[model samples]
Target: LVSYKRHLEIMGERNSYSKTDLDATFMRMKEDAMNNGQTKPGYNVQIATENQFITNYGIYWRPTDWGTMIPFLDSFRERYGTQSNEVVADSGYGNEANYAYMESNGIEAYVKYNMFHAETKRRYANNGFLVQNMYYNASEDYYVCPMGQHMERCGKQHSVSDLGYRSEVDVYRAVNCKGCPLRGMCYSSVIDRRSIKVNHRSDSFKKHARELLTSERGMMLRSSRPIEPEAVFGDIKFNHGFRRFRLKSNRKVRIEFGLVALAHNLRKYSAILSKRMMGRNHAYATI
Candidate 1:
């Protein structure tokens, strides 16, 4: 990761947007992933196609897809040095940051967030909760429970599920969740308050999150990501038997993914070739 960043001349300090710091953070994550045997803080390789060939592609190592838009565009620009004119991505990459980046970079981007869904609503209803049912209180810098319960930030150590590193965190819990009227909908614990665990160094994260959530384009972009990325994955994993990782290490994984992408392009090209052979003015040709 460090070598790639240096070679690309992409990781660097910025006046308004420090690309170096961002790259450094991503590199750290990659290192962490390598050490821990996880994909967290990793880069994703994307291949764009037209007429069954990879017209453009890139590797983005940002923590979230939202941040990848600008970097992807920048990388594309660096590679082709030409404007795509129009771009399309999923909701994960659709936030204000990405849209603004697209607009600034002279690319018209289409991205959608997964804002509303009947299935999601139904599931939440079953659980008696809704999206953002749990949220952080910025003014007080604490987490607010679903049932309007405020959990004060307690300087305590607690083990959170899914966090690879065992670290201390600020714990917040509903003061009187046990006796609260909304207990049924809020907590399954009677003896303890509704605890909301947060990392100690979470200010920047919180800010970025708010920016992603508040933007209209963010939501829109998220919606497109699932469709586009899912389609890409489905073609690779389901159709091409790429469900298992064929190689170890980031470099090998990249090569393997590239080959899979190459295969996909070849298939697409074959279809086009077959159509062209049929006739220029024929129905197959049109297809």
Candidate 2:
């Protein structure tokens, strides 16, 4: 009991920690060697790229990428003393809090939210049971369910994320759903009335993001996102064979990765310089 208590004290708020590296978290490793999805001690690294160059980066202990976006951007701003005019990322980094941050900071967000692609499909849009598909009376602040029952806003539910971001969702309940035949199809609540939670602010953010992400410039930028960050990761993992970190602790790993980022940028510059030199040599030869 004493040994377990000591270990728990050392772990703190984290679920698991590596004894070898106190700062390292035991997270599920992406590359499961035996295909059993084994856990390994590692850190989640977030990076922003502009034209294939690493503009900013942050090391986070959080396994989920959604919560990392805000902190990563904050670090980028602190380092550069300015925020980027526009940001583009995958659905994993999209959330209400992240969108709000970008909006308040005046950064144009071309980020995709969860189920963004799925929501664009015909089935998703045509589904009557979906809260999004239901008729919403903005003037009265109420929703008309698929059964034509008025769902009035009852109250608000407030919750906080693990990262300490507070958000509120409005709860709407139908007047009576006891006799409705579609009650089973809509909600499975034990109560007679059907209730649903909706965050109008989040919905507004998502709507705006959809517009930005679907634009011509946004499409061009989105198409190149994979080539930017993913390509760099591929080069680091496959081409450069930098799969495992030689450093033990998070602070040491950060410094090690800093060198890696610098090296990648230097290699790109060298390649560009070599190409220019070759072009000059060809021009002189032709002359």
Candidate 3:
């Protein structure tokens, strides 16, 4: 039908769209309505903050934060005319692609991986069977199985992202997994030879990221990151009551949010100026 053709045109690259707003994607709302899995038409907003000021912002149709990282950073670079020296973000922004992007740009990434918090727990004896805990020999390019079996480098698996970025992962397969004692502790009922797909590039990136994220300066930045965006969001939504978008389409909505951010910055500046007039040395506690 004509409607199908029009919808195909509107949903060019996206999987879903709202008829009311063609550019709006149906994303899961942040608020969990009692796990009802409610979805609404909206755009994912990305913002960078420094000392509680919204420095740069972007509007994304991508629902997940990980996929939006590169585009958001690119937007920031486009606006600032240079890449950031240091980037601090939560686990949601930590991934192979993001880490690679930062490393190639010489940016210190103080980003936590998906396993960062879980790795803090005491790793048990059985946990040694996990791929991450397994010993990797860089020179040999292989992994050691829990039962002392040598998992040699066999082949590679190629993965292409939604953005069409291709990355290769080296797959290591155990030389022998038949009749191994630790087989039950490792995998399931069907006992094929044990194998693990490892992205060497990503692992290296993650190792560097872990080092940077655990340093003293990294700790301070990580602690301060929450204060930057969370407070601004609270100020705008809770205090200013500027949650709902006033516009319909994407471009208009972006402009509308820009005004909201400007209002927030001006209000914050007014508060700081007032505090300075009162002879306060530090206003709003600069980071």
**Which predicted model would earn the best lDDT?**
2
lDDT of 1: 0.56
The residue-by-residue lDDT of candidate 1 on 132-246, one tens digit each, is 4456667887666666666777667755422122445676656766566766766466575666666544333334443554468656655555566567667776787776544
- Clashing residue pairs, backbone N/CA/C < 3 A, model 2: none
Model 1 scores a TM of 0.44
Q: Which ten residues in a row have the lowest lDDT in candidate 3?
A: 278-287
Q: What's the lDDT of the predicted structure labeled candidate 3?
A: 0.86
Q: On residues 172-213, what C-alpha lDDT tens digit does candidate 3 reach at each position?
A: 888768887778888884757887888888888888888888
Q: Which structure is stronger by TM-score: 1 or 3?
A: 3
lDDT per prediction?
A: 0.56, 0.90, 0.86
Q: Report how far off residue 251 is in candidate 2 (Å).
A: 1.3
lDDT of 2 by residue, 227-282 (tens): 99999889888899888889987789999999999999999889999999999999
Q: Sort the predicted structures by TM-score, highest score first.
A: 2, 3, 1
Off-target runs (Cα >4 Å) in candidate 3 are: 32-37, 124-126, 280-287
RMSD (CA, Å), candidate 2 to true, equals 1.6
TM-score, every prediction: 0.44, 0.95, 0.93
